[model samples]
Target: MSTTNTDVLVVGAGPTGLLLAGDLATAGIDVTLVERRPHGLGNMTRAFGVHARTLEQLDARGLADELLATGTTLTTARLFGRLDLDLTRLPTRFNHLLVTPQYEVERLLERRAVDAGVTFRYGTELRGLRQDAEGVTAELTDPEGTPLTLRARYLVGTDGHRSSVRTALGLPFPGHSVIRSIVLADVRLAEEPADVFSVNGSGDTFAFLAPFGDGWYRVMGWTRTRQVADSEPVDLDEIREIARKALGTDYGMHDPRWISRFHSDERQAPAYRVGRAFLAGDAAHVHSPAGGQGMNTGLQDAANLSWKLTAALRGTAPDPEALLDSYQSERHPVGAMVLRSSGAIVRLAMAHTPLTRATRSLAAHLVNAIPPASARAMGMLSGIDIAYAPAPGTGRPSGRRAPDARLREGRLYELLRQGEFVLIAPGGPAPALPSTAPVTAKHLIRATWTDPAKRTAVLVRPDGYVHWTSN
Candidate 1:
């Protein structure tokens, strides 16, 4: 039984933990990641839609283009069999949603984490965790039941919904199951959709179809007539029946490669942080899979918390509690919002009753009629419009996302690959916070606008949010 110490201990090697650990390691902080599963990217995956904001985050890390190459992109998304959520007009470099599996994302992030020197301990399970005024101690056991101890200044539980770390913290996950007996399948479609993601279902049944960019389509459907358990055996005939009812056709789906049954739940931990241990990803919140927001939300959580932890570890932030507390203040509300929005989407799609279906119709018509409303809806779903509440008198720019800008020498996201605070001054100097000089500022990058005539300087956080503006 040996003990280890690091600056941060990240439980779970999922997307959230991988990104957080990579970001920390890139910032020159020591991070150790532990997982119960073996070190391999397994094939079972359902999460596929990667939103624009997530691509922006990945772009900042220099992995977005690589990820894009591995997936298909849908410029427009149809909802409720009619209304369209256009993604082409989003004000970002990566606008459309990239449809790729969760495993593909994990593969890239894991590679980045490894390259950044994150210590990984696979087949290690967290049994218990405790935190004091100084730090957290995590008790672990290997596959052979050998005990190991880990101590870190900060610990994060990105271990997901059935999180052992969250359980160890004594936090209550309060929510109800949203949908049941939803079937997922990967098969060769005799007829592929004209648009990459147009197959949608509404009425007494619900179904969705999208390509996996490998000649296979991921089909999801549910029905009232054949409600079943997650562990129950399922066949293609049942799936085809539900798809026919919901989608009008099954697109001649055959030769099933993988099939599974799952139930969606809407749950959120009472608190994200208890002392030095924090929860992210599915550990903090989870909702229905209607809007494809689960993995995207988790990745954004990693981006938001990574820099704050770095600031705290380096003793660079003046108010460490406020800085760390801001993670909860900023992200928890967003989590709640996603829960409501995604729940609504799933419920609308899964509407089996006439009254609920009528409400869905009316809601769809309302959004379709109002252009601004539709834009806002897509913005929220895409995570581009998400923002923290600014301090009083800071105005609109303080809490919003800083759009990727073209600098005189390069691009803002290109510069962000260094994982630092970026100062965009329109032909001006970085103000005196620590130091105005970029060369001297350890993790701060100073740049000028491509158009030298412009004159507003915005300081962007490492996670691409507006820290403050020089007005």
Candidate 2:
């Protein structure tokens, strides 16, 4: 057996792992990313919507423009077949959700990682891992089926559901299956609908369709009556019948490129971190794809963890263990919330009883009629209103996402591409920062502060969250 050492080991080269690897490599860390599959994307795409906040995060890395160019932007999101979440009103450059395939997102992140010198080993599988106080030892097999060993100070599992890393750590994925044997197909529509995106349900069936910005469209349909084994083969007629029953018509769907069936579960791991290893993305949580949040949540997880890991490894973190521990505390609740919201959407969509339908209809009307309710729904789905609590004894407004604003120098996010904390003070030199600041801080230009009345200082984290604000 041969042994290789790296500062950090990332398992699973999906969006989550790719983002984390890219960020870590950019911060000058020796990170290694391993994937079980070869270096290429399949035609199938599970996620299609890139919400506002995810675009913001990617914009900070200078990767959003290219991705946006490859997709179509839809400013409205219909919820529950009645209420609409107006995405255009969201306070961001990307006020609309970019409807594109998951591969587009993965491609941008992969390019960044490759440019940043991140080592990628394709066709490799992790057999097992053993972690102790010192570090983690990973047993792996390469493309040639040769046994290899890897040692790292920390390991992160961004693998999807049925994660090997989670299994090795014995993390219990506790939750039940929400929907079973749903049909997915990528095909061409001879008759395009008026709306670029649509979701509708009738009786015991649900269906959704969204364009891929190309000639193809993704069709997702589910019928309670058609429940079958995942191994069971599916044909175009079954998909058309389900769509016609759920959405009134199949919209002349034909020329199937690929078809498959999958089951969704609402599961969360007991803990995201265990000793020297951590779980993220689908490995940490799995939920119904009601809000198109599955991939977005994982990408955000990578953004949050990448800086914390980099700080710990570079000896810049004031309290390394606490910074690392915050990963689970901050993201686990978000995961639970995603499961709850997405589950609610799934249950409501699958509602068959008259009473349930009536109740759902009433709620939808209320949401549509109320402005505040509508705004909150859009913010939650777009992830703009995500916040955390103030850090203890910091006397600063912490745990809130720092909104992007223009300064004399440049945009707030554009300044963040250097991968350091940005501290904005009213005037003079930068104010004294908290001793427990997790990363190196860069002082913002005085012009960055819009208000002159308050001379307080605000510290923004590397991930663009407010670390502390002195008032």
lDDT of each residue in 209-245, candidate 1, tens digit only: 8887888888888886777789998889989998888
Supply the TM-score for candidate 1. 0.96
lDDT of 2: 0.87
Report the number of backbone clashes for model 1.
0
Relative to the true structure, candidate 2 has a C-alpha RMSD (angstroms) of: 1.6
**Count of backbone collisions in candidate 2:** 1
Query: Scored by CA lDDT, what does every candidate get?
Result: 0.87, 0.87
Give the TM-score of each candidate. Answer: 0.96, 0.97
Off by over 4 Å in 2: 41-43, 441-447, 450-454
